[model samples]
Target chain A: MIAVLAVVQGDIGIAGLAASGILVAVAIAISLWRQLGLERSLLWASLRALVQLLFVGWVLQFVVDPDDPLIFSVIWLTAMIGFAAYTTSRRAPDVPRVLSLSIVAYAASAVVVLGVLFGFGIYDLEGRTLVPLAGMVVGNSLAATVLVSRQLLIAANEQRDLIEARLALGLTAKQAFQPHLRQALRTALVPQIESTKAVGIVFLPGAMVGLILAGVAPADAVKVQVSVMYLVLGSVATTTAVMSLGISRELFTPSQQLRRPTQRP
Target chain B: MSSLDAFELRGVDAGPAGSPILKAIDLTVPANGVTVLAGPSGAGKSTLLRLLNRLDDPLAGEIRWRDRPLIEWEPTDLRRQVAMVFQRAPIFPGSVIENLRVALPGVSDERAGHVLEHVGLDVDLLDHDAETLSGGEAQRMCVARALLTEPAVLLADEPTAALDRTARATVEDLGRSLADSGVAVIWVSHDTDQLRRLADHVIVLADGAVRATGHLDELDASDDQLVRRSVGAP
Candidate 1:
């Protein structure tokens, strides 16, 4: 199977490589436009994507050829987790207390999902499955955690008075943020749920297309795609729930008054 | 005790030592009437009103509520017992119902509606968003929210200063009604004519010092002596 893929890749050659580069550049441009509209960061993000991809291509040659795959997989997973933590924390620093919690939630949930799918029972920890599967879980959870943290923190700040008023009325901290918690969870999950609804008809997701191009039968490819989709849903849901709980509890003292930050704005 | 007296200010001095805002102030407010603290700009009337609610702790005096030192009460408990209506209504961002619910979460929708009606607000306005309300409507809503707490004392800082004549008259009527219901009202106003119309007891201040304290009717009558003595003397 590897020999056939290598021969086909070689025949396509420079044209295939050039096309992929163009596609990646276009993808980065679109991501920049959608995530940060008309900001100076868009140009920085484009340049960063180009450099990061080149660096990854350089590193992957050594990493993929390893006899002992565990070390490579562990390093890759750590890098992904660090990126996820940085992205989530940058979106919401008001809840700095939950920075480590969000990262841990992402890592633990990703490990469990990827472990179950490619664990000892299914197969030995093969790099092919571990790499792609872990990538999906980590990437999706990163996006979801960012959404949950940013939305919930903004909600808490905007309604600080209302939340404090409720606390004064004998409500526990959890009860004070119950409404915002629900809203944040919904915001985190809605995009994933909507994409799931539109998966096969509106768009052919990457996993299914990649499987077909790798010469798997269409029926078998569909099965793998469904399982991967379900895994992603579970990982994101867990990350958002855990992160909301961790972040919401950081705003108040046990005495219920706002721990007004000492630094003046 | 009973309905005769609400709050007692003893030696309440809320400013610097050389020039205190409320210089050695002493006043006992009866439990159920309007006490207008009137003076020109920079007078300590607003400062004295804030001291009544302990919003500004006096630098050098004691405020006693029902014979107990105000410092003895929990701040939140005291806030619930004594609410302040800011001069310019500070409408929180959200729906009108949510804004009203902040002061007293225990109030039922029915009770909120009743309080709104008492404050001369339209029933339909409750569903409107808070940020869209006019200044006068927002002030009325603020008063309604304060009423939801059923506070014993309501300190209104220029409650109708920003309102037109019609809205001002409407708010003054509501203030009179609140006072009639036996809530001790300390109304701060820059308008002396409005005080003459609404105040049962009048206290005039000059640059953070109480100049005179007497009944409004006596001050308006030939007893211009009190006003003349304290009007310009700091």
Candidate 2:
């Protein structure tokens, strides 16, 4: 794939390869230094991601060189979105397997939000335009899912007796969980809101950083960053909402019983 | 003239080391009145009370409530209709109303206030977090929570042991009043004086078996060595 892409798109030479290798080594050293006393899992995950990304970079060189790049890009992004949904739901068994719904919700929201801002004849489907925006949406949604699931689980466990008592007192299961459910949803969304508030002053986000590095003007990079931020926020909210609703329904039966956690043999 | 005898224990044996806490015990408490389980420490009094609520199942024989075997009772329904107050009050975190609300979902704030009053708790204490309440106040809230269910039986294990003398007397009074209002009260306590003061009938246990069963006065009149010794007779 890398050979084919080199033939098609001119050469991305040994210089590019050396730069990537040197950047990766530096990133690893920095991460290991920062995580000095922590568990080895972080270091292990970084190494795995590096190897996986290199493999993916080789494969994408061919996939992106195809006659129909748009279709290939759609397929690639769809796979990312689908896997994000699956990983998030599996992490929270209490969440319903709304894989299809989450995919549609996230993909449709991301495309609309990203496409309008980028596809408005202002920006085109360049690698710089598409890849970073998708990464923001996919990554944020995964984190949101984690936050939502952890908060919901804690709220549910802590208030179990109160929930049972409420059920006995003639409230439906949904009614019993309503307060905590709302709280969990709020907790999941708040961090994203705070980051959005901190956009230019507290930190320059990844999209702007990448665009600025690629020699785009500061104002232009900030504009693209703003659009990407909206896409990310929208996609994550839709995915989290659909997932939260589905997970709540799946975790509890219509008769208001909690589903037993799936046991392994 | 009752809502059916809500509980029955027959040949029930429970305790540690194969030595039953309540051996071959048979009891049918009336649907109303304070049924004091008066015994010394380790006499299986608490165990017998727990069995009524199915907190612990009998080792041998059976326990039934409303003609249905205790084991067959739906756990949720059983819990709702039969509330157990532990020896030391276990107040879960949350407001006083939240603690009271634990047994009855959708119980109105007004009704919670009423139940609190009925359990001898001041209405002002409703919004206070239960964990911070004094032992007596917490125990009263436990009773209030149980009462909110309109439970057929209240199984209390040493509900006042951790309270001061004034608080203990207050809780004992509340238990008697609850029985007077037509709820079956099965209370376990080692305080013979409180049992005599509050119980309509007493079931005394020495080891795991019933050593004496009758009204408090009858037990007092009897020549049982434990009772004689307990009464401080020389």
Query: Of the candidates shown, which would achieve the greatest TM-score relative to the real structure?
Result: 1
**Which segments of candidate 2 are over 4 A away from where they belong?**
A1-50, A61-138, A147-187, A212-265, B1-5, B8-30, B36-114, B126-132, B145-152, B155-158, B161-165, B188-234
**How do the predictions measure up, each by TM-score?**
0.63, 0.61
Q: State the displacement of the C-alpha of residue B151, model 2, in Å, after optimal TM-score superposition.
A: 4.3
The DockQ-based CAPRI class assigned to model 2 is incorrect
lDDT of 1 by residue, B1-234 (tens): 274346787887875446666777777755568888777778787777766655446778788887788778665677667777877776766888887877666667787888889888988888899899887888889888877767887888898999998888888998899888877788988776688678877788776666667775555553455474433222
The native-contact fraction of candidate 1 is 0.02
Give the worst 10-residue stretch by lDDT in candidate 1 chain A.
A1-10
Candidate 2 colliding pairs: A95-A247, A96-A247, A166-B105, A169-B105, B14-B21, B21-B208
Which is the leading candidate under DockQ?
2
lDDT of each: 0.72, 0.69
Q: What TM-score, to 2 decimals, does candidate 2 have?
A: 0.61
> Deviation in angstroms for A220 in model 1?
3.8
Clashes of 2: 6
Question: Where does the lowest 10-residue lDDT sum fall in candidate 1 chain B?
Answer: B225-234
